[model samples]
Every structure is written in C-alpha cells, then in structure tokens.
Target: MKICVVGGGLSGLVSALELAGTHQVDLFERKPVPGGCLGSYRIGDYWIEEYYHHCFAGDAALLDLFDALQVADRLVWLRGSTGYYVDGTIHPLTTPTEILRYPHLTLMEKARLGLLTLRSRRFDVQALDGITAKDFILDNLGSGVYSSFFEPLLKSKFGDRAGEVSAAWLISRIAIRSDRGAGGERLGYLKGGFRHFVARLEEEATRRGASIVPDTPVEEIRREGDGWVVDGKSYDAVVSTLPPQVTADLAGLDIARIPYQAPPA
Candidate 1:
C-alpha cells in the first residue's frame, strides 16, 4: 500500500514510522523542518523550542515514545508554578496559602473552586460537549470565579473565542493537571530540547522506508474513482495531521466549523 501522510508534525511523522515497514509512505511538511509547532530555533550552539513545551507524568504515550527512542532517561520532572496578575500585582496561586490570599474571590467562592477542582477528574467530559466553558464556569464555580479566575486564562489562550470554547476542553484540561502539590504541578521535559525527539522520529521513519518531503505544503486533494489523489500523486489512502478546517479546505469538503486560536504573540 502507498500512503500519503500530510503535515510532518509529530503525528504525521509517527504515523509514517508506524506504517513505513509495511507500506510505502510519503510525509509532507510545510516548513523546512518537520517539527511543526514543536520546531525549534538555533541559538549559537543550542536548539531552543519555539514555544515552551512540557509533558505530564500521565503522558504515557509520549513516555513510551521516549523509551522507544532510547531517550526516556532524559526525562526530567520539575515543579511548575501558576499565578495571576491583577491590576499591577502578580499573585502567585500555586500553593494553598497563595490561593487563599487571592483578593478577587471570597473564602466561600475559593472553597467551591477547590471542590470543583477535586471533583473535576470524575466529570463526564463528553456530556459537556454542548456547553461552553464560560457557561460551565459560571454555573458551577459562580460568576466571580469565572470572571476573576478562569476568564482571564481563557481569554489569554482563546482571545475573543474563549466564551465559545467547550466545557469538555476546560474540564479535560483541569483533569490532566489535577496532579498538584504544595509547590505546583509536576511537569516533564527532556534533558535537552525536544528537537532530539523530532530528529529521532524522522530518522527512524526514513530508515523504515518513509520518504519525508520537507518544504512542501499539500496543495490539493481529491477523489479519483476508488483511491485518492494528493498533490496529483495517487495514494491508496491519505492521512492528514493538519487542522480540520485546513484539511477540509484542501480536500474541498464541507465540515462543521471548529474554532481555533493562533498562538499568543
């Protein structure tokens, strides 16, 4: 089988690696490099990630991949702090004492927020698909918590579309970071940069017979009788790791709108 994997981010690279041994695979990347969002920049003698990237203790798949690449030993656990800035003051909210000192929420409101955080892991996130994050926070945690706490965080990430973001996204995000201690959440990072991970993935996939085409953005995809045509090349199947709207645009298909926000400047 011949497979066309679009967007040589981690997902596309890993997919090609998984399929290359048994099938002819071609992975396309728009950038000169294959890391996609995980791409890094050269700083004198070192590579630094374009964005701050970290993992959780619960990231099993990522851990397994690190093990497979013989780099699991590079995983480092660190305590990360959280905070809020209001007016001109920076309020650190990592520890219980810090949270208690926050001026915006009442003691009762803080208790309610704590309770919700404790119970967030048990939430049926799928049931929240239809509800907005704004509504979810307002209903369960009260308007004070929503406005004083979560709204700013949401707005920071999603901008004007924050209100339209789903409760499932909010709940699942909370659940994943529920492993917290007095200092902060336990987060993982590679000893060096994640560029090593990307390099290993690309090397292994190519060794297994995958052809990686960098500096190539998929321009067109269309059905041709039984199989598919991607960029005028015939393939038994096409797998796109690009965003849904982008894939829909290239494939010329209609899909329900899914809101996305670009990275903060």
Candidate 2:
C-alpha cells in the first residue's frame, strides 16, 4: 500500500516508521523542519525544546519508543513543580501546608477540590461532556471555588472561550495527571531534549524506505477513485496529524461552529 502521512510530526513519523517495512510511505511536513510542536533550539552546549514537554510514568509507549531508539539512557526523571503567582509572590502549592495556606479557598473548599481531583479517575466524564467547566464548578463546588480557584485556571488554559470549555476535558486532564509526590509530579525528560527522539525516528523511518518530504504542506486532498489525491500526488491513503480545524480546511470542510475544534491555548 502507498500511504501519504501528513504533518511529519512525531505521530506522522512514527506512523510512517511503523508502516514503512510493508508499505510505501511518503511523509510530508509543512515546516522547513519537522517535530511540529516538539521543535527545539540549540542552547549553549545542548538542545532544548521550544515548548515545555515531559513524559509521565504511565506513558509506556513513549518509554518503549525511547528504548527502541537507543536514547533511553538520556531519559531522566524530574520533579515538576506546581505553583501560582499572587500579588508579586510566588506560591508553591505542591505540599499540603502550601495548599492550606492559600487564602483563596477555605479548608472545606480545598478539601472538596482535592476530593474532586481524587474522584476524577472514576468520574463519569461523559455526563459532563456538554456542560461547561464554569457551570460544573459553580454547580458542584459553588461560586467561591470557581471564582477563587478554577476561574483563573480556565481563563489561562482556554482564554476567552474558557466558559465554553467542557467539564469532561478538565476532569480527564486532572485524572491523567493524578500521579504525584511530596515535592511535585514525577516527569520524564531526555537529558538533552526530545528532538533526539524525533531525529532518531526520522532516521529509522527513512532507513526503512520511507520518503520524508519537509517543507511540503498538503493544502489539498480529494478522494480519487480507489485512492486519494493529496496536493497533486495520488496515494492509496492519507493520514493527517494536523489540528482538526486545519485538517478540515484542507479537505474543504466547515467546522466553524464546533466549539471543541477551537484553536489550542
């Protein structure tokens, strides 16, 4: 099978690598360089990613991939701190005492918030799918918690459309990050940067007979008989790893009214 994987990010490269042995793969990237959000810069003696990134202990596939790429030795465990800045003061809220000292939420409210965090893993998030996080906070935990606590978070994470963000997404996010320690959350990072992983993945995929085309964006796609036409080239199938809105625009589909498809924060 001939496959055209779009976006040439980690997902696209990995997908192409996984299929290259049995299929003809052509990976296309819009940017001059690949890695998508995982791009990096050379800082002093080493490289660092442009965006903040870390792996969780629960990320088995990522660990396996790192090991397979022979970059496992570079993976290091680090404590990721959580804190807030208020009135020019930085408050680290990792420990129990710091949380208790936070003047915004009362003891009861803080307890309830912790309970919500604990229950997130078991919560029927689908029930809150259509409900906004703002409404969910106001209804379940009351206005004090919403205005004092979650409001800033929602605003910072979702900006102007924070009120329209679904409760399910917030709950699922909390659940996924539930693993914690006394200092902070334990996160994995490569000693240099994740760009090494991207580089290795690209190398392996190309070595396996996949063609990676950088600086070539698939602006157009159409179904052509049994195959698909991406740009002006035809292939058996196309895999798009770009954001939903971008993908929709490429395919000439309208999703403007879809709130979930709103641009990332």
Candidate 3:
C-alpha cells in the first residue's frame, strides 16, 4: 500500500515511521521543519521550547517512544516550585503546609478544597463528562472556594471562556497530579533539545524507504476511483493530520459542527 501522510507534526512523523517499513510512505510537511509544538528555537546559548510542556511519570507511551529512539538517557527530571498570587501576595503553594497557611481561603474552605482535590484524583472522569468543571467544583467544594480560588485560576489558564472547558480535562489533570512523587514534582526534557529526537525519527523513516517532503502543502484532497488524489497526485490512501478546519477545507467538507478553542501561546 502507498500511504501519503499530510503534516509533519509529532503524530504525523510517528505514523510515517511506523508505516514506512510496511508500505510506501510519503510525508508532506508544509513547514520548513518538523516537531510542530515540540520544535525549538535557539536562544542566546541554548534551545528553548516555543510552548511550555512538562511530562508526567504516567506518560508511558511518550517514555517508551523516547526509549525506543535511544534518547531515554537524555531525559532529565527537575523539581520546580509553584506560587499562587492572591489578595496582592504571591504565596508558595507547593506543599500541604502552604495549602493550610493560604490566607485566600478560610480553614474550612481549605479543608473543603483538600477534600475536593482528593476526590478529583479518585473520581472517574467519564462519570463527570456531562457536567462542566465550574459546576462540578461549585457542587463539590461550595461556591466560596470555587469562586475565590479555582475560578480565578481557571480564568488565568484558559482565558475568560474558562467555564466552557470540560470537566474531563480537570479530572485527568488531577489524576496525573495525584501520582506525583514525594520530592515535589518531576518533569522530563531532552539533553540537547527535542530536535534530536525529530532528527532521529526522520533518519529512521528515510532509512526505511520513506520519502519526506518539507514545505509542500496539500491544497486539495478528493476521492477518485479507489484511492485519493492530493493536489492531483494520486495515492492508495490519504491520512490527514492537519487542523480540523484545514482538513474540512481540503476535503471539501462542512465545518459547521466542529467546536475548537485555540490554546494560549
């Protein structure tokens, strides 16, 4: 089978590498380089991530992928601190003592917040799907804690439209968080930068007989007799991993029902 993969982000690159040996793979990337969000730019002396990302211990798939690429040894675990800016003060919020001493909430409110956090860690996210996060917090922790603490945090993180966020996101966040180790929290980063991993993936794909074309965008996609045509080039199968809006335009599909929010950059 001949497969044409559009986009060269992490997902597209991984998919291409996985299929290169079994099929004739052609990867088309509109950008000059791969890595997508994981891509980095050179700073004064070191490369920096364009966006913030920290891997949790439970990210087994990502860890395994890094190991398979022979870059596992480069992964580093770092402990960091967190602060809460409340009532004209930046309070350290890393430990239980800090939580208890937080002046933004009363003692009862703090206890309620603690219980809510514990419950959030254990609760099944699927069961809370139909409920919004704001509603769930208010119901479980009372309006006081919700309004005084979590609400402002959510707004700062997700913008003014934070109420539209799904409870499932919060549930997953808490669940992953509850698994953190005793020495504060640990996050992984590559030794040099993620570009090393990206280079390895591209090399492996090419060595396995895959063709990668950068700066080539698929302007259109249409169904032919049995395969699909991408900008008039025919292929047995087409895998599009672009944004939904771009995918809709390329496939000539309606975009009326899809709802998406842009993440803060």
Candidate 4:
C-alpha cells in the first residue's frame, strides 16, 4: 500500500521508516529541513540543536531508537543541573540540599512539591485530561507552588497558552523527570548532536524506499473515494503527525478545537 505521512517530524519520519520496508511512503515537511522540534543548525564543523533536549534513564523508547539507529554509543550520560531565577538571584535546585535551601515556597509547600514529584508517576493521566495544569497545581500544591514554581516553567515552554495546558501533560512531564541521583538528574545527550540521529533516520528511511519531501506544506487533504488525496497525490492511506487541529482544517472536518501552541520563531 502507498502511504502519505504529513509533518516530517520525528514521529512522521519514524513512521515512514517503519512502513517503508513493506509499503511505499512519502513524508512531507513544511520546513526546509526535517526533524521539526529536533531540528538543528550547523555550527562550523558541528551541528547544534535549535532547542535543548535531554533524556532520562527512563526514556526507554528514545534510548531504543538511538540503539536502532546505531548511535547509542554516541549517547553520553551527564549530570544536569537546574536552577530557578527569581528577582535578582539565581537559586540552584540541582540536589536535595539545594532544593531544601531555596527560599521560595514554605517548608510545607516544599513538602507538597516533593510529594507531587514522588506521586506524579502514579497519577491517572487520562483522568487529568479535562483539567488544566494550573488548576491541578493550585488544588493540590497551592497557589504558591503554582505561581512561584510551575507557572514560570509553563510560561517558558508554552508561552501565553500555558494556562490552557492540561494536567495530563504536566503530570507526564514530571513523571519523566523523576529519575535523579545524588548530584542531580542523570541526563542523556548525543555526543556530536541529535542531528546525527535525525540524519541517520532519514538515510535509513530513504534507503528503505521512503520519499521525503521537505519545504512542502500540505495544503489539501480530502477524501478520494475509499482512499485519501493529499495535495494532488492520492494514497492508499494517510497518516498525519501534524497537530490535530491543523489536520482537521486541512481535511475540512468540523471537530472540536484543540488548543495548540506553535514553536517560537
């Protein structure tokens, strides 16, 4: 079967790679280059990630993807430090001692924060889908933790739409970062850069007979009888890794709106 994959991000590329072995695949990316959020820039002899990313020991799928791409050996485990900047001060929150020393929330607030971290993984994420992160934090950890601690983070990542973010995403993010050590959280980074991983994925997928079309925004997606027509080309099936709302708009479907935040320019 011929398949059309829209939005050539990591998910689209990976899907293309997986399906290209037995099916004809075409991946469309609006950007000049693929990788999407994992996109990078060439700095002289090296590639630097446009957005910073790191993995925890718990990132089994990511680690597995690295190994599958034969780039696992390039992964270097590092102790990543974190800090909170408030007023004119930069307070380190890398270790337990530092977290305890930070003078933001009260001891009780700190206790609640720690408990939330510990309990984050056990949360029923599906049940949190209807609730906002701000409400969840406010209800469980109080306004101080929400305003002083999590709000800034949400703002930094999500910008103005931070308040609309669901608690499910927040809880899952906290759960992902729960792995810690004596010094700090153990983080994983590719030695050269994640660009190598993205390149390897593209190469493998292409070698397996996938066509990657970059700088091509999918303008149309309409039903063509039993199959689908993307732009002017028809495919046996269509897989969209684009944001749900964007896909819905392209297909001319009237679905409930899902709030989305585009990456910063």
Please give the CA lDDT of all the candidate structures.
Answer: 0.89, 0.85, 0.81, 0.91
TM-score of 1: 0.95
On residues 4-53, what C-alpha lDDT tens digit does candidate 3 reach at each position?
A: 99988888889999999999999998878776777767778777766776
* Per-residue alpha-carbon lDDT of candidate 1 for residues 1-265, written as tens digits (9 for 90 to 100): 9999999888998999999999999999988988888878788989899989999987889899999988888788988888888899889988777888999899999999889889999999999999999999899888999999999999988878888999999988988887787777898998778988999999999999999999998999998988899999999999999878988999997966577655532
Top TM-score model: 1
Comparing 1 and 2 on TM-score, the stronger one: 1
Give stretches of model 2 more than 4 Å off. 43-45, 253-265
Q: CA shift at 154, candidate 1, in angstroms?
A: 0.5
Q: What lDDT would candidate 4 get against the real structure?
A: 0.91
- The best-first sequence of candidates by lDDT reads 4, 1, 2, 3
TM-score of each: 0.95, 0.90, 0.89, 0.94
Candidate 4 total steric clashes: 0
Candidate 3 has its poorest 10 consecutive residues by lDDT at 256-265
Per-residue alpha-carbon lDDT of model 4 for 1-265, expressed as tens digits? 9999998889999999999989999999999989999999887998889999777899888889899989999999999889999999999999877988889989999999999999999999999999999999999999999999999999998889899999999999999887786688888999998898999999999999999999999999999889999999999999999888888999997867887777764
Please name the candidate that would achieve the greatest lDDT relative to the true structure. Answer: 4
Better of 3 and 4 by TM-score: 4
In candidate 1 the C-alpha lDDT for residue 264 amounts to 34
